[model samples]
Target: MRLPGPHWPSVAGRARADAGPLLLAALVVAVVTVLAAAIPPLLSATADAAVRDAVRRDGGDLQVHSRMEDDGGPSASRIRHPRLAESVDDFRARATEELGPGLRAAVHPPVATVISPTLKITDGSVLRTFQLAYLSREGGPAVTWITGGPPEPTGSETASVPYGAPPWPVQVGLSEADAAALQLRPGAEIPLADDQGNVKKVQVSGIFRPSDSADPAWRLAPALLKPVAGADGRGSTRFAGLLSRESLPDARLAFGPDELRRTAWFTPDPARLSWDVVPPVAAKVVALKAASGSSGARDGSLKWETRLDGVLRDVSAQVEAAFAQASLLLVTLLTVAALVLLLAADLLVRRRARPLAAARQRGMSLPVIGGELLLESAVTALLAAAVGLTLAAVITPGVALSGAGAPGPGAAGAVAPGAGLIGAGASGVSWEWIAPVVIVAVLAGPAFGTLTAARATRDRRVPANRSARRWMRDTARLRRAAAELGVLLAAIGAAVALHQRGTGGGVLPASAPALCALAGALMLARALPFGTRVALKRLLRSRRPLAVFGAARAAATSTRVLPLATLVTAAALTTYTLTLAAALGSDPSNALTLAPAPTLGAAVEGGPAAGPLAAGLLRLAWVVGVTLPVLGLLGLALGAAASAPERWQTLTRLRTLGLRSRETRWVAAGELLPPAMLAAVGGPLLGVLLAHLTFGSLSLHLLTGAGPAPAPPWWGIGAVAVAFVVAVAVVVPVEAAVRRRRRLSEVLRAGDG
Candidate 1:
């Protein structure tokens, strides 16, 4: 060119020529990136929904209850005079503050109350005891008066009165049911005497009913609304009457500092909760409980009780188990994706071998050539990853929509609004998984390119003696054996760790299946050559020329470890996915499988937490079912195509000896079929073995609600094997047909060149 300009036109032409491999590289990167980006949001949504459902089911049990009993001790008497109401308020505030911000924001305002010990009721002749309750108006339950208004305190602050003396009585409200059972009405006065013979009279100020009995305010003491039969077996009934907040100070005084029980209840608003806040909230609750019991508490006698921590702990455990299962499946998918990428890269290297060799012969530096390849690959991979991430974010809603009507309440665990590139939920997308996938995709191209270029450009001289060649072969064999042994040991260790630690083992357990597959693949690759050689020897003895040639060709082809590994792993994953789906679907109690009653269906049908898990598993199964076979076939095609040049030269020579094109295809089929058949047969068995090994440690019952993991589904495994074999059978002819189109003259000219 004029002025010796850069060969942009030639580079463009080369790029156009290699569009197939480049596009494939990009597509693989994009797909893996999309998968990586999509998984975290789905898991987050599922976990959040599960936590919400658990919180909802817990109902009032999740309310935090803090109470203190003061026996008129010197310490209690000191705090009683200045107004016990302030002390009660202080306790409520302290409990709220200790819950941490996340939970504090979720809690309903505390309902403070004062409770009196059992005292003899003098109004009724039954000699019963009445429990006095002073419910605060600020955060108390809404009540509708059936007869009279709420209670109000009298002006007197006397702690007690003489047993027979007339005294100012505390005014109290009672529920209609309680009023009827106690034979008392508004304005009726009941005299109660303590164990020490000190007396106090309480008049029924009102008869009322709670507006919502299920409200958290009423849950603090059910006895306040209804009479509780004493556990003494004497059939003694104790009735509780509610006094207004204004009477709380008087009630405290009348009961004496020693006999009063002051309490506060804080209920959480489920709407404000999500899975992400569970651990911290639970920890805070535990801390609050411990602080209440400790001497450092606001009141030395204060005691805190709440099952919220336990409820949240159960939710956390379930979420972790669900995540472990999901991670296991995702890791398998990623491993297979990695293998496919490597196979594609290997194909690309083979395609560029001739041009790369020519450049090296023309005095082009290896680094320069490698850098150019690296640049091209890096650009393609990056662009593909960007497109993939975009597509994942876009299609996430659609994927979620497809499972909208799934059985569980959490089944529609769609990504929350505002989820993007910032965080896990509304704020942004979580990049914990997405970043690694993108990095791998972007680097895969350059790494494979640079390495292949270096290998191709390295100078090599043929071994001069048979002993030298044997030594080299032995060295390579030993290296492969050591690598295989290492993978096997790693797999064993991962399995042990998974078994011991279960879901707590983190991502380490996820690698066991992949490592096991790698070890198996290495062994299969080692065995393939020996098997092919035996076939070749047997064919040579038979006088069938086409069979002999095909066998010889098959025996001569180098062992294809990458393609074999890809196919085996894909098959194993497919088998495992199908088996798991079958087991999950087989559950008789699974809402997904059950049909509603024909004519008398009940009004409410609740699904288990496992519902979302099963839905997710089925979705994953569908993906693995569709994806693995295609990738396996692609690997087979690439492996076959890598040998295209040599195959074409061989076919040309055979054709010169009058071998028919049909017979030449048989030779190609011979080379492809053995490995395909081996993978088809062995992969499912390996998958079943993997399932057996891992399911015991997986605790799948936590998600499936089934008894022990069922045996691997034989029918499904057989079907997967059949489908894989059929796919390879179909691919064989098509590949042979493509090779048949390569004219002998062109192949001959290319060989000469």
Candidate 2:
């Protein structure tokens, strides 16, 4: 019977020797899992916040109106019918209840009129305004006074006014400019006549000014009720005024039929309102309408208009869509990371093949050997899991970053349901989901290690057959080429499908660049060996000894060019994304880095320079670009280490042949340089081509409005150079380190010529 493998003492020695690579593999798994856990939630939160803010900046969440259509008929001309008033009341109550306390709700009579007041300006020109009246409800705009404070309360307010002294006023507020033009001031009395020629004197209780907030709603509020000379024509200072709900009856007495005919009331325009004040009020408006039931819906002429809800929902959907794209990118990145880790593990396993083979020959069963390796893997996995989970927990809460600059008015005011969106409040990581994440991280390292170790052992057991090996070697190239071609074709097909989907709305597919990058890299890697060999052969014919030797060596090592190619391809993908973003002049990195984490923030900053979806895609692309190359570099390092044993032996032989150490290092450096250089040039070119192919039709106007194609991203070239330099730096040291540890005699005695 075969004996079981020795216990910890025997296994510990081998584990120690291989600890560096094993730990590196674990680290990769840990880091990848941490990033994976953190990214989606963070990106989702950020995108949501950004979209909400953008929508808020435009207006509140929605603009709701219960309106009776005026077909310019005599019936439409009636201003104060009981059915209309009751409908408005019902709509307001229902909207408040249904929309909940989080939303702002207001009731307006759908009344806007061009009122030619009985009062005359100092210049003897009659002043007119486009007048709109809002009922004083639980949530409605206050007629704020910029000067002389608010007017005294009038006993005329009805029960509908819920706050602040019943919201009754016998006076009006005018914009500073309008008041000045009309020679009016605080407490000034102005006479106004109704369509029936009834006249009443209304007091100008205050002179108001606009706030610093650029919210067009509040900024134009003072003037919306008033008239502007520029737009309303230059006969007089067309007055803009603010009036309380209690003043409505008196207003009718002072205004004419022409004014009444021009009036209709509705919720404030979303695009015209401030973000901070719109959402809650809008929700309240919706609730009010729903509560009104058939009262507001009685006639075909009566309609409830709500455009902001759909707009807000669409904006939120954009965020969710961007999250999907970011998730796709994360998946791609993780896949690349997994592939790199597996490659490195395979190399480590292969390096230990001779020891494993000897053990097997000494009566150690495969299962016994496999158990020890499995134990080592388990240990590594546990460590990785702990690190990954810890990191995930710490980082997740901090990732609720805003994709847009800040939460706009929609996120501002009260803690409404709308405030639960991304960037509006702090987001916590769900521990329920974290257990699975930890498990995945734990499994990542061992799964790949065990598979590689099992494969290596099996290969060891197979007896050498030169002809068979020759056939396998020859066919490997063909298989690689076929795989590359297949990938390219599949990427092309996806690109076509993506193109047909149109970029009119929602998030664009992230897979386009990832697939293109993979296909391009693989195709280039597959072709590199043959092309290098052919070119080197041509150089070999020159017959200069050093040149011949270098070219011959390069041609021989061309078989192992995939890792270098992969490194380049990954770098290229990153470059392409950043270049595209830079070309558009919208730096996603700035927004991401500068944005605040989700919190019950004060007031948020301004809108993002880029659209939420656009910024999100760009940010995801940038992150993927930065991270993928790291995986590529790790793969290259493993590839270098895997080839170290053979390289050291070759260098030892050269040293014995009277070549100095410096010359040997140069030869080694040169061996690595060609592939590195080839990848550098090919990688960026492929990336640029793929970018153009996938996003060529995307708005060039994003970069420069209706202008010619903008300049190429020169920064991408710099990135390539940096990546190349880093690759060279990493590769050369690996060679030198391996060289330092080896001696001529050790190599000579180890069965080398």
Candidate 3:
């Protein structure tokens, strides 16, 4: 017979053997990767939606108005007078070019006005001072002619027509409402005198009504459509008369260059506005404003005025704050996910211990074993990451440039036909998120495997040198205590820093909740055995042997820091989510919670209003709602599974002592329930406390429309705590059932072998 060489299992066979643990690892990795890939884009879209909605709702305030007065100063002479040398179209083209694409520029080229203290209309109404300004026919508001038609330019260049005397009066139009209020109708002539006492007569060529009063064009000059009350205490009002474009020259001649003003209003295309572009656009607007104010500016005579930059800055701030809050929550989830991945890796290593020990017995080096595990894990994690990233890309909706059909409140409108979408071309996989998760998943395998193998091979026999052993034991205990104390102190420091600096302080403040949770978990872990020992003593006094046996097992149970921390952190995150939802839900303007706010307040005095920012917070809450529960459940299940082998051994012994399967499960439950219950109860309390400590510092008033932060949602917290308990209770039985299905003989043989 041919000498049989050492046999190794085929890759397919090994994969089949380790399928359960590997599959679990793959699933966890995939889920985490999906979260990493999906969240950034979703959050980005949310921010984009918030920003765009605010911009659109800005309405008239969004206009960039540049006014150039014919001051006839030295700076005015230095500026190129494009209007003087070019046609109206050429001047418009030049202005449009200067403004750039996506901005519609309307040139209200130098218009002369006749400002009079009083005007006498046909009905003998002596109206207060009315200014008759020539309105540019180009880009004018759409209107329905109630009586007559729009004014036509007469082409007359008369400097001053004697009131009601020369070549017909300058043709003008008035809103029907204005005409009705002033007792003026079509064919009515109003005589007005300029500041220089030059007389001009304007005849109402038409009485019209705006087709849509909300039209942005009407916002450019509202006084033309409605009268404005004068500042005088006598209740005098100021009115505007809309003269035909052709009358501009005549008015200019009569009023002189001193009274003429050239204004150009630029309205940005809402479709072009997004969160990413806000800074650059805002910078440009600021620069424009600065240039307009400078004597050396290209168009020094023009003064550009806009609240757009201030509005954009406010929007940027709100978005950053919202992002900071969201980032904290997301970081919490990632921390929990990392802990769960570690738990899963530990489970995988435990499941592979027998095979790995056999390999070591066959003379495999620790490095070789670790390398194999690392390769296997890296391959599995990479594959999972690819699938997860693809799935995330497929599921996430593309970011639309068009504001139409946005999910935000008051955002729905007709979609522009050619609007661009940000899709696969802009893959939202934030590498910052992906790198950490992928590194953890890949490294967890080999790290846990190597350390576990090293521990397994360590000599466990007691040393004959009692004094040295005692010293070593004390040294180890002291080191652990020092480590725990250091962590605790660090946690406290972080919390204080977070309270002082708030979320804007970056990573440290964001990590505070996790640090606090870890500190609490560590303390609880240390206290658990002592607490269990007390329970054990109480149980030993009881008549029931199952209770006494369960208590003993629980007292001897090893503390797992990661699982406890994961559970506590998940609970806290869930509580925060519920609390935030409750606060936003309580707002009377439900629009802020349900979607983008129906209106965005001007960033005039106080700041941008809280509605859009609140809506962004609600979106983050929804994200937390989906993610935290899954992470918590996964952690709970993994924790339960971690103890299954030991629980099974106890169950076997209990059964040998004539206990029923149901009784064995009860014993197992008793062993697990105390810690689970502790986490369930303590986690929410910690969350509530954290909220109290951080909410005020979080600038939450921005989300609550400057209101005080709402009280914690006690009912919801209780419900979450109860649900956690129920989930843990359910998990214990499920784990027991699964363990029971494994034949007792095999379990015993495996344990012995």
Name the candidate that leads on TM-score: 1
CA lDDT of 747 in candidate 1?
70
Off by over 4 Å in 3: 1-14, 59-123, 126-130, 136-189, 193-199, 203-219, 222-246, 294-300, 399-427, 458-462, 478-490, 591-613, 739-753
Winner on lDDT (2 vs 3) = 3
Best by lDDT: 1
Candidates sorted on TM-score, descending: 1, 3, 2
For model 1, where is the 10-residue window of minimal lDDT? 415-424
* Residues 1-753 of candidate 3: C-alpha lDDT, one tens digit per residue: 854332335234555787876787688778877766665566566556666666666623322223333424242222223233123334444444554432332222222222323332323344465666543424555678889887765543323333223433457788866787777888877666644555666778888887778865555566678886762226666566675555544444334344444445566555666666565566656666775544334442445566767666666666656656666766766777777788888777776777777776676677777777777778888998888777776656552222122221111111111111211112246556556667888899789877777766767776789897998899988998899899899878878867877665566676777678778777777777788888888888889888887787777663566677677777776776677667665667644245543222112222234455566567656666567767777787777777777777867866767988888877877777776777778777777777766777665655565544647778767776777778867986777667756776777777621
Each model's lDDT: 0.66, 0.53, 0.62
Q: What is the lDDT of residue 223 in candidate 2?
A: 54
Reference-based TM-score of each model? 0.82, 0.69, 0.79
Candidate 1: list runs displaced more than 4 Å.
1-7, 59-87, 116-132, 137-147, 158-168, 175-185, 189-201, 207-215, 221-240, 249-260, 294-300, 397-459, 582-587, 592-618, 705-707, 739-741
lDDT of 1 by residue, 278-331 (tens): 655777777777766643454445567778777776666566666666666667
